[model samples]
Target chain A: MHVMIIGAVGMLGKKLASVIAKTRQCNGQSVTRLTLVDIAVAETPENPAFPIESLAFDLSHTDTAPLLTKRRPDIIFHLAAIVSGEAENDFEKGYAINLDGTRHLFEAIRRERDRNGNAADYRPRVVFTSSIAVFGGPYPDTISDTFFRTPQTSYGTQKAIGELLLEDYTRRGFMDGVGLRLPTICIRPGLPNKAASGFFSSILREPLVGQPATLPVEDTVRHWHASPRAAVRFLLHAGTMDSSRLGHRRTLNMPGLSATVAEQVEALRTVAGNDAIALIRREPNPDIAAIIAAWPQDFTADRATDLGFRAERSFEDIIAVHIEDELGATSA
Target chain B: MHVMIIGAVGMLGKKLASVIAKTRQCNGQSVTRLTLVDIAVAETPENPAFPIESLAFDLSHTDTAPLLTKRRPDIIFHLAAIVSGEAENDFEKGYAINLDGTRHLFEAIRRERDRNGNAADYRPRVVFTSSIAVFGGPYPDTISDTFFRTPQTSYGTQKAIGELLLEDYTRRGFMDGVGLRLPTICIRPGLPNKAASGFFSSILREPLVGQPATLPVEDTVRHWHASPRAAVRFLLHAGTMDSSRLGHRRTLNMPGLSATVAEQVEALRTVAGNDAIALIRREPNPDIAAIIAAWPQDFTADRATDLGFRAERSFEDIIAVHIEDELGATSA
Candidate 1:
């Protein structure tokens, strides 16, 4: 099977690539070839078991989608997006990459499928990474599987639009698509970024490394999260799962661990003791607090759970996964 | 107030234009000018009204939106779209006219609003007509305000996307917008068309006019509906209502009456007597039945009701509305 991964340089994309390379298969089929595409060419996964082609291409360019789609990979993992903060800060660029780029890919796939007037042969499984941000606040305590999406931010809006397009395209038989509304990846393996929600990860990731980290909101503030491993697992599951099981709603709210800031801290303390907990400085910024306040704290995620998607049961398990995966250790 | 109607040649658009002309005002502001736009120029309404400009323009064109927005009408009623059947049959044309066309208009408005970045002026009230088609079944008995949009058709998908864009643009302060999810308009005045739902209107309309009409589905099949006059009222209400009152969710499930086809026939019998009902023919088409079966049956419509948008309380009242509006009579 030929598998294509867009946004192959991003953290999750990179991890997913390495895992696929190690496994040498996708959806129970041998990976004959792997295509990695991004704005910058990704480094080839070390000692890959399949022929790997890394391509540097901007999806926002009108020609990029068609060029990439012509190869007709058996499975396409579309993980590219402008992060929420950047999208909000730069509207045009955000829409260009997040909206137009995604649309172009879908349209390109349709065109390729119908290249010959009578030929409707090419149909690939498109696994798109949507986000929990597609929802906004004035949310129920635990958002149900069927809650309406009223995104407060432009990034969220773009993702919501992408979900709609994915469903429509899939329904029209242009592609077999699955949209995973992924929760924020906690214990993200890197230095803290400027995203309002970055603290959710940094506070844990930094402390695990014996470094000081900042906490921007009250301990009572709750948010949804999943480990990077679980997110990648979701992509794999979506890629392999029967499209008929998805029914008419192509998007699924991925199962996640919902915890308050204090719960996250407690989990860290359980894993790394008081020294790591003490490293978290309580310097609350009200602007970030207000932004986080409007975010969804929890979701039922019943549909995904029923469809055999799973997440870490507890925050401690989440921290453990991070340590095992990122630190290459069993314990923090 | 300068009012512009993008689909001024359509049935509801023409009625809205005539009503506005007769009132000589909108939102308590005197009507100074009226701009009617469509694929073909609309005929001018009768005298004693504001200066009227009817323009022939296709919104799908890249330049048309910018040209239309240059004038900056105070209230822009965007009621343009490709019908569901056409959209289903011609996928590319559907996306081109419905999706791209809507995006261009919104983008044009944004550009027009930000022409002078420092000025932060030119925010117009954009009232968009969405539809109940945004919902598909496997539905609840009564779809609530918060039900997720899982559009089964391309046209519905396009409208759902438009709603998302409307909310985002409004939230960003690019424009003040309102999206009304209009129910099926019943007792339509014109001759029966090829639409699957056409019988919902023709059953009553044709019989009332002493002509035979076909009923394609079972009498037990329920559906939501509003009068054309009520649809126009919803538009005007959306255009003039305080933006702040809409809060974060700019789109509304417009108030409508939910009734079974049997109830419609009973209402027709009550109003026009058995002589009119005798003209009804039962055809029982499986194709049309399957199509109607998947449509939304009812809605709570609490939000729109609370917002002061009103609709006919009964199917009889709906028929009365048609009689008064089209037949030039107080009663059937």
Candidate 2:
């Protein structure tokens, strides 16, 4: 099996690559080769059991997609995207990269299938990373699987569009596609990216490591989240799952823990003590608060749960995963 | 008020144009000019109260959108699309005209807004015609406002994507937009188009006019529908309505009558007598039946209803509408 990971330089991408490298397989198939692609060349995973190739390509450029699909990887994990805050701030750049970039890749795959002559011979499993951002507010207490997507941000709109394209292309037999609407990754490792939800992670991650982090929204503000480990699991499951089970709706609202900022702080106290909670500096930013307000606070995620996807039961479990994985802790 | 219709040559587009020509105003504002655009030059409406220009253009061409938006009409009615059957048959043409074409028009509007210097100076009302095709089957008894869009066809996917763009662009303040998810127009006049739903109209239309029409699906098949007159009213309402009422979710499920094929035949019998009903031929084309099966059968368009949009109360009313509007009947 040849596995390709787009946006492989990003935090989740790197971790996913490391996991794949250690496993030496995907969906029970032996990994013959692995390809890591991003805007910059991704670093090689240590002691990989398979041949690994790294490529730097900007998918927004129309030509880049064809090059990426030239080798026809058996499974393609598309995690590349302009983060929410950046996309909201720069409309054209957001559409170019997030929307056009995704479409170009899908089109490339379709063209490759056409070139193969036997259409059935080249259909790859395309695992697309979507986000809860596809949903907007005035949401029910628990957003159901059937909740409509009325995205308030350009980034969300682009992602929603990508989901539509993914399902359509998959239905047309261009590819076997699965879209995972990943919840915001709690305690995301590394420095914050431009995503509006970055603070959700930064507040917890920075404090646990004895560093001060700004809390942009009030403690009462609630949001959905899952650990990096859970997100990676969701990706693998989507990549390997039987497409027939998905029916016509290829996207799933991933199961996640819903926690308010106050609850998150309490979880930090439970896991890392009072000093860690004290590191959280409350500095309200209305802009961030407004954006967060328009986001979904919780979801039923019944469909995903029924499909065998799972998430942390509590915020402490999420923080524990971050500690074990990123802080080099053997046990939480 | 300056009005522009993108698909001015289409059945609904022509009717909308004729109505505008007769009204001499839109949204209580005096009509100044009307621009009609299509792949072919549209015929001018008879005895116009304002100057009207018909232009032949394809929106899929990148340059065409800019030209259409050069004058910046006060209200833009984008009714252009590749119908469902045609879009499904030709993949490239579907995405080219339905998806890219809509994007180009939107981009053009945004650029035109930018060129105006003050972002507030040239914002126009963009009325986009979406379809019930955005919702697929395995549906609720009556689809609610918050039901997710899982389009089963390429044309539907394109419209759902367009709706997302409309909301995002509108939210960004580039243009004031409203998207109406029009139900199938029943008892349609003239020759049937390539839409998979064409038979829904033809079965009623042809028989009423003393022509034999094929019924490809069983009498048990249920579907949602509205009349051409009601569709025009929805467009006019969308074009003139105070958009602030829409909040962030701009697209709406327009009110429609839900009826079975048997019910439609009964309505036809009542309206045009038993002789007209006998003109219907039941051939049971499985291909068309499969496509129709995936379509939405009913909707509780409470949002659109509360906002003052109305459709026929019964299938009889729908038949009455067709007879009065198309058959030159003084009374039903």
Candidate 3:
């Protein structure tokens, strides 16, 4: 079996690649070939069980999709996207990369299937990483899987469009697709980027590492979260799960721990004591607060739960997962 | 004020143009110029109070959208699309016209806004005609505004994508847009097309005109509907309604009458007597029956109703409107 990971240079992409490299398989089949692609040249993981090929790929260009599909990887993990803040700031760039690029990639697969006489048997498993941002405010307390997607940001709109295309493509038998609407990754293992939700991770991640962090929103501001480990697990599970279980809808809201800012702080206190809690400074930024206000706070991801997907049970577990995975420590 | 109507050569477009021409206004504002565009040369409506121009415009071509937007019509009624059956048969053609074409038109508007220094105040009122096909089966008895859109057909997917784009563009302040998810237009004036839902109109229309019509499904098959006249009214209202009322969501489930085939037949009998009803024949085509079975049966269009948009109250009223408008009489 062969597998391809788009956006392989990003933090999650890199982590996913390392995991797949170590296992040498996905869902049980031996992965003999691994293709890692991103905007910048991706590094081939050292001494994987199978052959690894790294390539620079940009989906915004029309010709890039065809080149990427030429290998006809058995499974494709599409994680590439413009971050939310940037997507909102630059409308054209966001749609060009997020919307058009995804559409072109789907079309490329369709064309490839038709080009060969084996269109009847050409179907690849597509695991797409969507976000909870697909739901806007004026929402219910616990958003159900069947709730409408009224994205307030351009990035969310792009993802929503991608979800629609994915379902239609899957229905037409061009691909076997499953989209996981991921929650914000708690303790993202990287330096802060331009996303407004960066503070969610920074407040916890920075303090745990003995650094100062700012809290932009109130202690009561709640949001959904999962660790990097859980996100990777979701992708692998989606790739192998029975598409028949999903029926006509190709996407499901991923299960995650919904915690308020105070709960996260309390969890931090339980792990690292008063010293770590002191590192969190309340530097209120109204702009960031306003953006967070419109975001989804909680969800009843019943569909995904029933489908065998799991997540951390508590904020403490989430923090511990971050420490164990990122800091290489079993306990704080 | 100036107005532009895409797909102006079709039935609804022709009726809309004639209405606007007769009134010389839309939303209480005088229409000084009218631009009618379609894949074929649109026939110019004669003796209008305003100046009218007809042109052959195919949106599938990249250059056509920009050219159409050059005039910067204050109101744009975007109703162009390939019907369901054709889109299902030809995948590439559907995406080209429905997806890419819509995107290019929105882009053209954005570019025009930025071209001059008046970007802040150049937002046009875009009234887009979406369809109830955006909602697939596994639906509640009465689908609400908050139900998720899980389109089962290629046409539905295209329209769903269009709705997402329209909302994003409006949110970005590129344009003031309102998308109306119109139910199937009943008692359609023209000849039957390739649409699977064509029978919904044909069964009612043909018998009213003293011609035989076939029913492809059981009498219990329920579906949502509104008259073509009501559809035109909805578009006109959307063109003028205050965008402030819509909040962040740009689309609404349009108000429509929910009736079963039995109810439709009963209404037909009331309008044209048992003699006309005898013209109807039961010829079950399993292919069409399976297609219609997956469609939405009813909707609670509360949002549209609260916003002051109205439709025919009953199936009898719908039949009456068709008779008065098309047959030039209150009854056959």
Candidate 4:
């Protein structure tokens, strides 16, 4: 089957492409063609078993979505979005890319599906990478799958809107859509982006690699997380999962380990020894702290667990995965 | 202060205009001008106390929003939308009017607010009419203020998206926005439109007027409602309320009477006698029944009540209001 990944130049997207190329199959069907897209130019992974097409395309532009749709990939992974801080700072750009871009892609697919009056025949499996940011606080300790999405930021609002459109479009039979609400990726494998949640990874990622990193919030501040490897697995599983299982609500909260900053530090100490933990510096930025305060701490993602999507059981396991994936044997 | 009503010719919009004109003030401010616009030609209210301008315009059109923004009405009542059943059947038109049309208005407001670098001064009070359809079922008997919105229909999706935009736009200080999640308007004073919930009104409306009406579902099916008068009052209240108290979430579930179809019939019988009750014929429509089954039945509208938005407490009260307002002494 042909598979397409938009935002395929990003860390998780690259990991997902490499994993699929290595595995050669999804849900027991061989992936015969891979189309990778991003605003940044994507380089084709070496020694892939399938035919590959890499393209740099801005989804917000009018022509790109239709061009992608013309390929008619059987499976589509849509992961492109502006980060939370960027979205908050540049309001118009945020809505233009995150909201309008997603809508354009969905519309393109929908128009293609309706072209022949055989919508059912042409419907593709769409796995949308949503975020836990979709849920804002005044929240319970563990936000359940059914909790209200009153997103506090423009990014969250955009994601929530995308989820709604995905559900609606799926209901209309234009696509088989599954929105996986991913947790903040801890020990992310690259340089930090402008996301408010970046500190969650940086405080762990930098310190463990013998470099000092700043902690913006107090130790009591809790958050949900999955490793980059786990996030890729989530995308793959969502692409393969039974759409019938989702019913009316297309989005499911992916499972993650909930840990306070103290817990994360302890996990880091366990995995990388006391020297690694000592590399962490305490610095408080109230702007970032205030943004983090309104974020959801934990989630009871029982729905995703029930559907067989897995994540690291503890922050130690999350750190171990990151070390193996990014640092390998050279780590402390 | 000038006020604009985008759906000025619709039942709610027309009633709202006449009510405001009769009072000649909104939230204690004298109304100097009224702009009434609709896709159909909007006739200026007879002997309007304020200087009233009526125009035929489609909100979905590209240029209409910019034109409307040029006037910069101090209070904008955006009550325009394609109803649910129509939205479900005609997908493109639903999105064009409900989603894109709403976005255009919001963008226009945002642009005009930013035009002079004095967004705070240009910020207008925008009262948006949302609906209970925003909440799809798997609901609690009394859905609280913070319940998730998982709308099953296209119309509900559109409204949910609108609410998100309203909140974000308000947050950014472009507009002072309030979204009122109105109940199904019981005994709507008009010929039935294509809405699936139309029977909620028709069953009561036709019976009270000594005309036959069909009940499409079982008598045990429960629903939430407010009278047309109460709905108008809710709109006006939303327009005038202390927006500072709204916090970050701009929308509130307006209080309404929750009653079973059996209870509604009982109320109808109390108001118009057994002969009137005899006018309702049971006609089961599986499609509509399925749709209604997925709808929210009740809500704990504590937030709205505390905010001073009120509705009828009993189905009989709703019927009485309909009689006094629509039927009067001429009804059988």
Candidate 5:
């Protein structure tokens, strides 16, 4: 099977590409070629057995998706997006990348239906990255699968709209799709300060590397879902899942931790010893607090669970996964 | 109270404007003026007691919403949109008017905060006309308020996206808002053709006025909700409801009928005699039947009902509303 990863140079995209390359196959078939897409040309993931190609064009460019579709990969991992903070800062640019860019990608796949001759199985499987920020303000006791999305930021709203489109387009057979609404990726490897949730991981990743990191919100502030390993696994699982059973609602909220900042700090202390916990600074920025409060605290992913997706068993597992990925496996 | 009715010349727009004119006042003050806006000049409602202003400007044009927001209405009823058929027929036009126009309106109201200093008492109320098309596809037993929107058309997709924006913008305190997902309006008092469902009403409405009317779907077909009177009342009620109880999700599924086409025909026969029913033609359009079947058969509008929004009790009342509105209350 041929594989493509849009935003292949980014964090999860890089991790996922590496994982797929290492495995070399899914269910015993070889990954013949890998098409890596990003604005800054990505370093092609070296698969000892498979061939590779890379492109550095902006996905929003009218011809990008169609050009990619011409290659006709069996699977497409679409992780490309304008981050929340940047999206909030530049309105038109945000909509251009997150909303219009996505539509362009899907339209490209749909146009392939009769390229040769009309066939039932012409479209490739599409895996889209969504986020938990899709659910916002006035959240219930436990965010259920049935909760209607009331996104607070322009970013969240855009993601929610994308989910709707992915579902409808997939239902119409434009593409076989699975949209995973990721939680904030805990202990995100390398650097903090860009994303609003950068501090969450920055506190952990920086400390493990012997550096101090700021905590913008109070320790009691809670938010939702998963580790980077879990996100990659979720994408892979969604790629191979029995989509016929899921029916029309193609997108889903991936499961994750419901712990507050204090709990996260506690978990870090347990996993890396007291020295790591000492590196976090409690600064309490009200702007960040206001933004965080608008996001849903947790979700009961009943549907995704029923569909056979899984997540880390505990914070120790989350930390262990991060340590193995960022540090050497021996460090954990 | 100052009121503005955008899209005042369209079918529903004219009905709503006429209703608002008769409302007299809101919260104890006399309605001082009524502003009507549309892409073309609007029908001036007979409101001799109040001042009236009509503006002919394309909302899809640059800075349209900002221009309208300058009027500073106490309550603004935004009914401007290309209908589903037209939206599906022309993709670019659909997004331009439905998505971009809606955003422009919200952005304009958001700007009002900076210029006016956002007093607690000063924010205008924005009411959006959403549609049942927001809920589509082969449905469940009944579409409850909690059911997720899985719209099929470009129109439905746009409306669903519009609902998300309305919620987010309203939550941020840009302005108070309410979105009403109205059912397919029956007995639409107009010409005899077009709109897949136009035949549902035309089969009776046209025959009453002595014309041949076609039935595109079987008489056994069933779907959901309201008379124009109830729908107009819904807009008014939504504008005045206690939204504090609604939390961040402000959109409501306004109430209506769940009757079958046979039931509709029976209602018509009872009200207009056998001659009206005799003019019906049994010509089915598959494109329309497919679209109509995908629509929800019934909706459990528990939320809207609990919130105090009501609809006509029966199809008989619906027929009465059409005659009264079109032929006058004294015609009987």
Candidate 6:
């Protein structure tokens, strides 16, 4: 089957492409072609593999829909979005890319299918990567998959709106859509991010690099999380799932460990020893405190789990994912 | 306290204005001034009890925010909306009025407060009239206030987005916002509407005027609703309640009666008797049937009751409201 990744260059995007490119079998099965797409120029990987097409073009322009319709891959991995902090900072740009760009994709595919009339059985499965940020303040118990999404940030608000549109369009028979509400990715690769949750991964990634990391939040602060590897797995699984089983509730909250900052410190000590823990600095930021307070500390992802969606079982496993996948190390 | 009603010319808007204007008290307390806002040209009612201002200018225009800040009323009944049926037909206009216009009001209030700092002391309670359209597709036993809002229509989508912004802005202390998810307004005044659910009101309303009316669905199809009087009471209650008591989670499922179309028909007979029933035409429009099929049948509005919000005791009261309010008859 032909697979396409809209944002095939970002952290999870790259991981997804690499995983699908190699693992010729999943629970024992054969793989085929992979198509990668993004606004920026993407490079074709080396070695013999399925035919590759790299496109460096803006998807927000009005006509991008026609182009995507032309590409018509069987499975679509839509992982691109305006990050939270940046989206909040640049409101117009964020809405343009996140809201407008997403609509363009759905509309394009919708037009194609409308013309095709479902006779050829040619509808592609589109997996949308959503976030826990979709849920907001005054949470009751653990936020169930059915919790009303009252996003606090502009980014969260945009994503929640996106989820609504996806469901509406899908209900109208536009495409086979599945939105996965991913937990905050822990032990993220690359430089420390300006994201409020970046410190979660930074404390691990930075110390592993023999550098000091600042812990902005307190030890008792708990949050939802999964690893980049797990995120990729979720995308793959969503791509392969049967749409009939999903019914109308196309969005699912993926699993994650609900651990506090203190727990993360403990896991870090176990991973890189107490010396690395000693390298961590304490600091306080009230702006972040307000944002963190609105977030759900955990979720009861009964729906996603029942659907076979999975995530890291422990913070240590999350830390290890970074070491093996990103830190140039084989299985320990 | 000073109160303002936007979109005062619409059916419910005008009814709410009249109720509040004639009131000796709102939420059992005296109200001082009432401002009625709309884009259409309107004249100040000669018999307006308290201070009343009727303005005729587009609230969706660029300059509305500053103009509103200058007026700066203490309590705002933000009943302004593009309306469901109209919004669904015109996408761009729906977004501009329903979404951008709301943002403009909030931003205007924010800027006004920013200029005066805490000394502004000008924060007003805002009551947003949301709709049951916020809940779509997934039919369950009873929709809790905790149920996720997965709107099916573009209009519902806009309202859901508005509720999110209202919650976040209220939480930020820029405003105190309360959103009431009203069920379908039954016994609506004037000519029949193209709205999918318009048949609910048309069946009774048109027949009362000695005209034939159409019934769209089976009597067994149930939905939630409050009488016009109950809806106005909800607005007044929301405006006067102590919002600090609410803390966060400002949006609420306004109390309503869960009645079937058959019960409504029975209520019509109870009021107008056999003559009113004979004027009803038995016909179902497929387009409306498609839309109504996905609508929620009932909601467990336990939260609203606890908050002191009220709805009609029965469908009998709803039909009686139409007689007492619209037909100018105290006794049917």
Clashes of each: 0, 0, 0, 0, 3, 0
Whole-model lDDT, model 3:
0.89
Overall lDDT per candidate, in order of appearance: 0.92, 0.90, 0.89, 0.89, 0.81, 0.80
lDDT (tens digit, per residue) of candidate 3 on A211-316: 9998988999999999999998888888788989999899999999999999999999999889999999998999999888888899999999999999989989
Clash pairs for candidate 1: none
TM accuracy, model 4: 0.97
Provide TM-scores for the models: 0.98, 0.96, 0.98, 0.97, 0.82, 0.80
Q: What DockQ results do all the predictions give, each relative to the true complex? A: 0.91, 0.90, 0.92, 0.89, 0.48, 0.46
- Give the poorly placed runs of model 4, Cα more than 4 Å off: A192-195, A330-332, B192-194, B330-332
Predictions ranked by DockQ, top down?
3, 1, 2, 4, 5, 6
Q: Which tens-of-lDDT digit does each residue in B1-332 have in candidate 6?
A: 77778888877678777777777466777778877888884446677677888877676786886687667777788888998888877766787798778878877777777675663576778898888888776668788878888777777887887887788668667788998888777777778877777888898888877899988777778877777778888888888898877756788888788888889889878878899999988886777777777888888898889989878878888888888888899855
Supply the TM-score for candidate 1.
0.98
lDDT of 5 by residue, B122-151 (tens): 578889999988876656787878777777
Docking class of 5: acceptable
Docking class of 4: high
Compose the digit string of candidate 2's lDDT tens values, residues A24-122: 877566778999999999999666667999999999999999998989999999999998888988999999999999999999999998786767778
lDDT of 6: 0.80
Ranking by TM-score: 1, 3, 4, 2, 5, 6
Enumerate residue pairs that collide in model 2.
none
Question: How do the residues B18-79 of candidate 1 rate in per-residue lDDT, one tens digit apiece?
Answer: 88888877756688899999999899976755699999999999999999999989999999
Candidate 3 structure quality by residue, lDDT tens digits, B164-262: 999989988899999999988998887876577888898888998899988889999998999999999999999888879998888999999999999
The residue-by-residue lDDT of candidate 6 on A69-172, one tens digit each, is 66777777888788988887876677677877887888777777756576345567888988888877778757787787877777787788778767766766
